[model samples]
Target chain A: MSGHMEITLNGQTKNIPGNASLQALAEQYTKEPTRVVAELDGAIITRDAWSRTILKAGSKVELVSFVGGG
Target chain B: MPPIAHQTAQDSFELGGKIFSSRFLLGTGKFRNKGELKASILSSNARIVTVALRRIDLERHDENILEYIPDGVTLLTNTSGARTADEAIRIARLARASGQGDWIKVEVINDSKYLLPDNEETIKATKALTAEGFIVLPYISPDLYVARRLVEAGATAIMPLGSFIGSNMGLRTREFIQVLINEIRVPMIVDAGIGAPSHACEAMEIGAAAVLVNTAVAIADNPPMMAKAFAQAVEAGRAAYLSGLPAKRPQGEASSPLTGFLFE
Candidate 1:
């Protein structure tokens, strides 16, 4: 329990390793992390700062990318 | 020494301090394939393209929309899923964080039946986004009052719907859109409801600076060809407008002189 924690990701609850950074979470979902924008709670975390921004238990994260639209 | 004369340049589709020769603003949606989308964009020669931001499709990891768009094209991110000004603002900020340009099409719609834009909310979102130095384009009903308010709120362009979004209704509010084109100072990029190349042409013929389209081209049997057709129609319409389409006459006026006719 000490090495893992639950966090809300894209509106779904998920268990991630404890002390994981945003970059780590992003990599878990995408190989091209540079093409996404991460929103931690309500603030935008740019790709450059993702590696240093650590996630805490109960942290909410939303990773968004461009898609076809009108 | 001979005196030098300066030549002034004009850009027909200028928006957000950038000049684009093509008057077609294409939406990257509903394409059957990425290759066709890319081909359509290339054929249309649209300098400004729109994209929506959403959670990445985890299953389609092999494809990315951004990869389909070529370089040097401006991405005008649209807030499609937003139902309020605050939601639109949130989308705009996230789009900017992607390191793409700050051009956003603010679409605040609470209605589900028609997908008609809420004019008041669009104006509100435009004001907030423009203040943050984002090049905002607010989509709304073709109301003169709403247009004036949006322009005052710092919107770079006013995108009045020609009909309902994706309805392909073909300029149902033609007269209303003409009002904005005639009265509003900012560029009127007619958006939505355009279904055919001729529909896009009609909007341009009435003096629209540009038009954004998605459904017509995307749903065509051949998307790239259809995109080309729309692009050509837009250009032809612009040309007709520039050349001054003959004034409508209540009665017929013969092109040939009455006295010059040999049969007479």
Candidate 2:
């Protein structure tokens, strides 16, 4: 619980402290963490819940944001 | 007294409990850059713009595209990457969580050849998303049964393609769209494959609630100008439809005096 752990963040492996919240992961990975939606194991982690959802080892995270699309 | 046609009524189309007078929905894709996208959208005076969700590059995330959207414009996020109902639902949820509105354009396209929308998956997504309180708009080929099913599934509106996406073919499915215009009760939005302003006009003239255009404007020499043209065309077509087009005749009919004109 005190050592660095790894999880898949947006298809890339990232090493962070054990029990890091999704918000922490987003801050480390995204330019604007406020505008992104984080998904863990294919379930959306709402912005308000980001602080409570902890990323476990081997967790699959997909950080999606709005882009130009037709 | 106001003319009967000009009387106060529901002159605007209502979708997701919002009223929109402009019958043009612009797509915020394929533009040369974000600046052009903003300019074109402003020029079109569209109240709603559609965007797609994408994986944010963790290493070097670009500027947020939402910043390009002007004030007072409603954002419509689309499930462009989803190929199934479940995937579409997931995307829709994430889109809503992004703090953008709950308006989602459901696009379930498993077909790679023509990029046609899968109506079955679209219906499934519509039902699920609508149940979750998201305003759902399902894009599909012009099919009356599918349109009715989408409506029954609680879709905010039915977006029927005029032809292949970005094909510039201009309403190849005219007769089928007319069938939707006739039968479907919900707003019928002509979404993809509109090539020109005339195409938008034609859709509006046939009583479509709106026309969503992207490639035709984005790829034009002057995107802003094209957007303005489309806006004007939509207005003209809506006016024409409202004024009631005259019935067609096989032979030419004389409008001026047939035999009494001084010039004649």
Residues B1-264, candidate 2, lDDT per residue (tens digit)?
765666215577788888876779999889988999999988889889999999997668787899999988999999998989999998888888878889999999998889999999999999999999999999999898999989899988889999999899998998999999999888888999999999999999998889999999999999999999999998888888888999889999887867877786
Error of 2 at B259 (Å): 3.7
- The alpha-carbon interface RMSD of model 2 comes to 0.9
- What stretches of model 2 exceed 4 Å from their correct place? B1-10, B261-264
DockQ of each: 0.85, 0.84
TM-score of chain A of 1: 0.95
lDDT by residue for model 1 over B155-220, one digit each (tens)?
999999999889998989999999999999999999999999899999999999999999999999
| Candidate 1, RMSD to the unseen true structure | 3.3
Chain B alone: TM-score in each candidate? 0.94, 0.95
The C-alpha lDDT values of all candidates are 0.91, 0.89
Superposed model 1: Cα runs more than 4 Å off:
B1-11, B59-62
Let me know the TM-score candidate 1 reaches against the reference structure.
0.95
